[model samples]
Target chain A: MISKFTYGEAELVTQLQHRNNQAFTYLYDNYSKALYGVISQIVPDRESADDILQEVFINIWRKIETYDISKGRLFTWMLNIARNAAIDKIRSKSYRNELKNQALPDDVSMLGDQFVKSKADETGLKKVLGKLKKEQRELIELSYFQGFTQEEISKGLNIPLGTVKTRMRSALLQLRSMIEQ
Target chain B: MNIKEYISSGIVQSYVMGLASKEEQAEFEQLCLEYPELVAARNIFELSLEKRAFEDTPHPPAFLKEQFINYINQNTTTNQSKVIQMEPAIPLAQSGSGLRWLAVASVIFLLVSSWLAYRFYNETITLKAELQHTKEAQANLGTRLKILEDYEKMVINPNVAVVNLTPMPEKSPASANIYWDSTTSNVYLIIKNMPKLPSDKQYQLWALIDGKPKDLGLFDIKDDHKVMLKMTDTRKAEAFAITVEKRGNTSGPDMDQLQMMGKTQL
Candidate 1:
């Protein structure tokens, strides 16, 4: 019922900072799913991603005053908040400490597995994975999706750190080309 | 300050994927303001990455919206009450912040307004182009209407001689008509049912004066189903006849190929 006219990103963010409930609700309806989607990729667990999602929107409400239009769009800002929060949840002391003793996280590949198993024909992630070389996909998986730093990736994937940076750059550029196509 | 080196150094990628530190993030923002290509690259990465992330929206739980909205309602009400208490603390925060907020708001307002004005200007230009096109089309139609009106007057005039040319007895029932205005010498031919000729062959019109045939020029079949082509404007002709002839170098009418003939009785 509140959907009379939609506002652009800058105006919507301005309204949101002004404590406009309608704008916030519209953002929530439009973006929550996408934000949750990104969160699930990093966190790799639905329940935790949901919790991180709640924290993200609440953080957006609390911290929107700090959002500058020059930095990026509201969506990109929200995305960073979601990614940071999810990464923090995954890389917490306990999670890291437990990784020393356990096998690879069951949920690390859960989202990947779901897409590859049932929705392999889906264009988005599966197609990207298909087009990417094995090493490139692993680099993207580790660096971008799994939230690994260049050093961490070099150590994790047993490649030189300098190689990691160049590969990451090349992989991202390739991803851009693939996305365009 | 080598931008290509800086860009290829992977800081922009780090920034895009939310891996850049605060200093790197600030530097990237500055670079974006300075370099248009960097801004474009940043936009492309931001959009593509966001799109990549957005693809995995496996139907969120139905309860999510209701739960989030309920929390929002509760939080807003609490925040409103807190706003009153925080009024005393606002002065401490308002020192340079108030002016900064005003400046930011004004800049945003100017940018949005100018962009809107540019868009409006573009729309006006488009409309003017469309209007000019319509006027040209109208002028062309007016010219066409004038020609049709002239033809209509010739058809209706008593001074205009109407000659209906019947096909030769040996020929098929192919027919043609001529509206010859002796006053103007405007000879109009309406070929009613001429056989579709070969590409090398053309239909020629001959106006007979004192029993000698003068070439009235050759014509091909027109695409328009009903067309009246103005043939050679001969002032005085005893008769009009259509003959099939080779496209060019026709010395005279081929008597063997006479399709239709009618004499001017007027």
Candidate 2:
């Protein structure tokens, strides 16, 4: 019954505290679809994305009490968990490297990109990223979207964590400046 | 770390993205505790990233959500039992209190169920009480109906012309008496709670003319049989008398049969 936007943060946490089925349903109903999209983008395989999605929710349930409202919104906290779980699955050595190279067929791949473009047109996500340099975009994608750790990003890009860190900082800074403007 | 250096150190972006190592995470967490400005910036940074991520992800099919929720609930139940039992020692962040939340939820559920059960039981008791009360009322009504039928039979019988007989003695303070009209020359008798007649037969009533007895009727008495006698004839009768007889009526009453007499002028 509680709409995601209209419901207060305290009320959301309280419902979660009680593990109210409706609250949980409302949560998954509202967030899962979009989260699946993010997971699919990161993991690329439908079956792996599905499995990791389950793991993501388990982590969210386990870690929900640790979520501090003063720090960020519940959606962000959950999204972070989801992203981390998916990336952890990706980083596991057992998962074949071919899974990484498996480019989404242009039809499915372009769909996700186009979906992003349309949403960005409405919310200015692309504009925010556009304000940053290409290097920052790559770091933001690797760290945020692709779920690469700084060590992985550092080794992959032939750079150090400090450099990756600087680029990422400058990336967010540019985004903040553009939005403020 | 100095606030300025910390702001410029690029860790804030990693923290916002959740890419920071454990040590860096601890360091950033401490900075957030120390500086409210740093906390505010982290929130802003996290929010922008969330918005971006949300925008990047496509709206999933609604069925996928059902699937996810099913998966989550199942795994959570399995994982909850594996969590550590110790509390207060572990930070709230790392503490395994998942099952505790479930327990609290179950207790709330149990309380609600018990309340519903209590209400249902109370309603059933009330309904049963009403049913018993209704049955008692019906039983009492049934008894009253039998008494009324007896009274109706006594009033409507034509062969018994009830004569108003006053109590000879006030043994029963509230008693009334009656006599039967034997003028029809037919057997008839009526009594109301009279004394028992002797056996061998019973008390017989006769019409007397100049001390000669005319046979009226024979009657039987055992306990409180209300009808005393039915006489054969009351014609030419000037008085009424009670006598004992054999089991059947005798042509004339013997002296032993004579018990009591009452003169009638009319």
Candidate 3:
């Protein structure tokens, strides 16, 4: 069992860099749920999402040295790692074949709601997302959670590249205001 | 340069979300280093994202932690051996051509630094010359601005009366204006439109009081219309006039040579 000791961001980073087991345990305990949530959003399949989450944590442990504090927060860096891992898993040929065999739901929103309702204890985020306009919500879901590039989003949504960038920005700003309130 | 506009332009959000292109990312990172406000704005949005992530957190299976710990233990052992293997290889390479490489590197460094120093010296000289030119231009502008302020003050003064001198029939097309300060009785003349005077000749002004002409002053035609030529003061004047004269003061105006004339309303 991990101890209840909390570490400040700087102290935790230093300990993680030194490969301290206690700090690693603390990091996993504090952040795994959030990372898992993000992975599930992209991967949708619980088993695959779990595997991706494990890989994300391992990658974070191995790459802690490359993390620059001046560039961004620890959680932000970890979020990118989680997102990239999940997106990579879904894009791999093996995951696509596995999807075919399982006959998973083709509709992303249906799969997403099912996965969210089953795994997430809180429904606050879903309701918050509901408050956003359809276009704004789609922009956020595609770019942030699914790790789609702006160009890919533009092509997929049948909107201009410039509009995709602007819509994503406004979506994030709106989300920020909602979270702050 | 507009930090507020840049912050709201969505570049910061794009940067935080990792959606900015490579060029935009590089530019934003450089700007973030220079502007703490940009860093603060980035942090605010990042915090919001973190909060959003937390709102939907889903607990991973508890057994995953034990697996992760076992994997870390195995990796740490392997990583230690890897580091140990890398250590012995470093000294072996250093013992081979290390001294020769050091000598060659030092010589190259010396030559390159000297070349860089020479270039820096030339750049400093060029920059100094540019700085001197900029300073001279700034001083010239300051003097011109002061003169403009004086002109504006004189023109706006409530006690000053403006008299537009009409061209005489013989001196057609030549015109001028006289600004007469009633309080100080000082007169100033500005040539609105006049042909350039010969090098040996100048224009003379006169103040007419009760039909008597008093010699005011002499002035040369200038390309700059803003140049206000100061003239002799007068307690009373019914009219003002100019005459072409030799470049000196004259006691009275030559009525036949009068170029322009205008009467005061008073």
Candidate 4:
């Protein structure tokens, strides 16, 4: 479902703010995959991930008025919303109970295997991210994908708080270099 | 500050990743407004992140798009109907006598609606005023938070010199502190003890450099003393003094009315 309508950032924001359905369709078609990937990383359950993705789009549609261009890119804003919604879903009581009821080791390991298999099927992103040091990659995963605070990352990973920040910076800089290459 | 070092200090990356604290985020944003290079560096990192997000991400099931579009369509239609429902409904008359009765009903309706409209108009005015007041309060809180965060950053900064301004021996006991950032040369003053001045008078700060008194700026004692009040930046200052000068007077400090003086340990 490739959109024939191509829009620059400003133009897309304007059309979405005006509640143009065509622009919205364009937005969904263009960005939904990336957003769904983020959701699935945090939420392993496919059905719940689907629901959260839908919720994220509905939220973006309703809350486009609140998006400030000065802050960051449209994708960054949408990514935050998607991550937050997925995190909230996992944190919810029902989701916790559902997880508890699942056959923990087998189900979780299978899901983890599937996740790795999917990533392995992808192109250079996995390679680029794989090139990062294990600790650096873990820092990025904890902070970016899991929405953990730096302090939380420090505590959970048993790394110093200062080192956590420095490692995250180096990880991103390294990733940036690899991507540019 | 070296913009290059600042950019690579991980503050910008932390900001882009949404991991920076509120104070750091605010400070980064303030710097971005002044330095275009920071914005460019930030954009580079953001673009890289966007690329990572775009490449090799699994697509959501195709049916989700259809569900989303249908949901939006249903919501928009419901919203339109809601707007239509907000308008006044009209009555339909069946016959001549019914029409005559409808005229009476229309007159009553007109009178009642006018009253309700008048009340709603007044209510709107009140609500608008309340909203304006709330906005002002929110703005005030934002400024206060910014100031507090700046003070925290400055106090913790290693290069910031803290100078104590004490009253002259002959004058009543009064003191204040000046936080001078050696790197940025930004000066901030916090009044500790001072007599209230007459409305026509204000306190003026002077930065004494090379035996000359350079006018720093004037400040009001009436301001909340808990927060540091920013003063003019001075690159070189051997000492600092405060005098009770006439309000808005920027002339040389009145040595006769010198209230407090402090020599820098630098």
Chain A TM-score values, per prediction: 0.80, 0.70, 0.83, 0.81
Q: Model 2: how far is B242 from its true place, Å?
A: 64
| RMSD of candidates 1 onward, in order | 26.1, 12.5, 27.1, 36.7
* DockQ, cand. 1: 0.23
Candidate 4 local lDDT, A140-174, one digit each (tens): 66666556677866776567888877888898777
Instruction: State iRMS for model 2.
Output: 3.4
DockQ of each: 0.23, 0.28, 0.33, 0.31
What is the C-alpha lDDT profile of model 4 across B1-266, one tens digit per residue? 78899987777777876777899989998999989999998888788777877777777898999999997787676675563453333223312357677787999999999999999999999999999999999999999899889889999999999998989878878878999987788888887777788999998889988889988888777655543677666777889999989999968888999989888876
lDDT of 2 by residue, A69-159 (tens): 7666787778778777877766665454545454323222232232233332333344466556777766666667655566766776678
Question: What's model 3's overall lDDT?
Answer: 0.79
Q: Which candidate do you rate higher for DockQ, 1 or 2? A: 2
Give the interface RMSD of each candidate. 2.3, 3.4, 1.9, 2.1
Which CAPRI quality tier does the interface of model 2 achieve?
Answer: acceptable
- lDDT string, candidate 3, B144-249, tens digits: 7886786688899999899999998856697678888878887878777888888998888888988898888777777775447776567689999988887785
Which 10 consecutive positions of candidate 2 chain B have the poorest summed lDDT?
B168-177
lDDT of 1 at A52: 80
Cα error, residue B235 of model 3, in Å, equals 99
User: Who wins the TM-score comparison?
Assistant: 3
Candidate 1 wrongly placed segments (more than 4 Å): A1-4, A93-127, B2-10, B21-23, B80-266
- Tens digits of per-residue lDDT for model 1, B148-224: 99789989987789898989988878778899989888888877777777899998999998789988888887665
